[model samples]
Every structure is written in C-alpha cells, then in structure tokens.
Target: MANIFNIMDFLWAPWRSKYVADSSKSKREEKCIFCEFPEQNDDERNLIVYRSKYAYIILNRFPYNPSHVMIVPYRHISSVELLEDNEAQDIFRLIKITLAAIRKVYSPDGFNIGINIGRTAGAGIEAHVHVHIVPRWNGDANFMPVLSNTKVLPEDLETTYVKLKKAIEDIINNEDSLDH
Candidate 1:
C-alpha cells in the first residue's frame, strides 16, 4: 500500500517568513524591539501612535486582527511585577485610551487584552513586558488559523495606523476639552 500520509503540502505565506526566521535567534542575542523602536525617533514608521511618560502604544506588526496594538513601557522589563507604580499606572491609562481609540476607529465587537510574561506563556519578546490589546469581532475566528496557522487581515498596517492615530488624537483632545 502507498503511504498517503507522506505527501507534503505548502501554504504560501510570505509575510510570515520574517517572524519564522526571527524565531530561530537566541533571545539574549536579539535587541529588544520595544526598546529599539522608541529610540529611533520615527513614530509613524515605527507604528507608534501614542506616547506617554512611562508607556507608549504601538501597533503589532503581525496582528491577529486589524487593530491589534500593544501598550509597552519605556523601561524594558520581563514581568508586570517589575513595573514601577508610575509605569503601571501609565500603562493602565494608555490601555483605556487605546480601547477608546480602537472602538472609535474599528468598532470591534469585543477585545482580548492580555499580558504574556514569559516565553512559555507566549511572550514573543521575553525580555520586554507589554500588554496586547487585540480587537475582536463576532465570528472573527476562522478556519485559516486552525487549519493553516494563518490569519487573514482585511486592512494593511499603514491604514490601521492612520485611522488609529487620528482616533487616539481625537480622544485625547476630547478628554482635554472635558478637563477644561
């Protein structure tokens, strides 16, 4: 009898190649992207939409959904427990802002907000602690991730950044007006 299970198949996802390639690098040898992206002084190119004293909001280059973003502290740390009071507060505040912005722009049905501290816990950058805010909609989960380990996003990152940046700015401005 022929070995039917031995046949090979390929799923062409060129966009995921960078992530797959980077996965091979030793964590210690790689510079923390959360640290490096901020220092580059190019917020738009970096996909950083908002910055606060202790934390900032940046879009996830590889996203589970259209408006996925992360709230990252300026100081690099491995766990939330290591966060200083100000950093924690700033991150929390930014989370609220991010939520409002995503709601205003994407109008997601719901959200998945989480922090993955260690590599075992799903932290892609184990050296840095950040909170991810993934906007979710009803019936968003599909066969792609289950079958092919792929996610199909409708919009590109640049478009998402533009819409989110504007929404964040508008939200901040509205809050400022309310405070006055």
Candidate 2:
C-alpha cells in the first residue's frame, strides 16, 4: 500500500505532453485530424499508408506499438452507425489488407482491432470515428509501462511506416494482377 501511494513510484510520461499540447491547439484552430489528414496528399508527412475508395489507412501519430495504425473512412461521422453500408464494408476491407501488410512487415504475435466510440470510451478525438489496430507480442508489457509509464518503441514510426507501406504496395500489386 505504501508503494502504491508513493509519489515517486507513480509513472511519468513526458512525451504525452506534446500530444496534449497538439490536442489543445487542434481544438482552437484545426478541424478533425482524421478528416484533414485524408485531404492531404503527402502520405509521409500525414503518416498515411494507403487510401481506398471509401477509407484509408494511416499510421498512428502516437502509437501504442511500433506499427500501430488506424483505419478511417473518408466521411466524418461521430457515431459509427452513421456510416453508409459501403463505407462499413470498405472499412473492414481496409482492416483486412492492413492486417496482412502489418503481418508481413512486423509479424506481430497478435492484434487489437477496436473503435473507441466516445470521449469517455477513450476516443481522444471523438468527433470523427476511426478504428485502431494495435499490434501486441508475448511480453510487450514490461517494466517501462509498469514502472516508468513510457513505451519503448523498438523501431521508429517512420521506419515502420516505410516497411508497412512497401508491404501494402506488394499486396495491392498482387491483388491487381489476380483481378485481371
């Protein structure tokens, strides 16, 4: 009980300050990042991996894991129910391809595919709906989170993005050839 209540024992994450600062700035000036990001053509700057007819895949700016990504529809809607049937279908398709690309690139032991519907449900940006695909391993949760509350990314975000982007390209090429 003493260690639990000790201030020194509490985990500290300084990197999150930037995210909080960015969130505040976005609230003041920018529109929904999910909406604005797709509009931008620079996938590298925007962290976008692939764009589909109705949805797109982007690497998480703040990732829980190295290759963490989000599958988002082009249209902005708070409630997932607002999505058109085609949008819903495309989202799932995007997720499937994303998983394959991620598997090829990172070869994660498992994944967490989910959507946080509301602010209370852990949606940092709740105005637009998006699905998160978090990769996991056998012993990823280690001393860092338990002791210091910091995530140790084995590889950089851009590096993972490049690798996954190539994997997606290969998959897309294969699929296109098969379609003919």
lDDT of candidate 1? 0.86
Count of clashes, each model: 0, 0
At residue 176, what lDDT does model 1 achieve? 59
lDDT of 2: 0.84
Tell me the RMSD of model 1 versus the true structure.
4.7
Candidate 1 regions off by >4 Å?
Answer: 1-28, 146-149, 176-180
- Give the TM-score (vs. native) of candidate 2: 0.85
Evaluate all candidate structures by whole-model CA lDDT and list the values in order.
0.86, 0.84
Which regions of candidate 2 fall more than 4 Å away from where they truly are? Answer: 1-21, 176-180
Candidate 1 local lDDT, residue 151: 79
Q: What would the per-residue lDDT of candidate 1 be over residues 7-105, giving only the tens digit for each residue?
A: 355435555666646743736568787999999999999999999999999999888789899999999899999999989988998898889889888
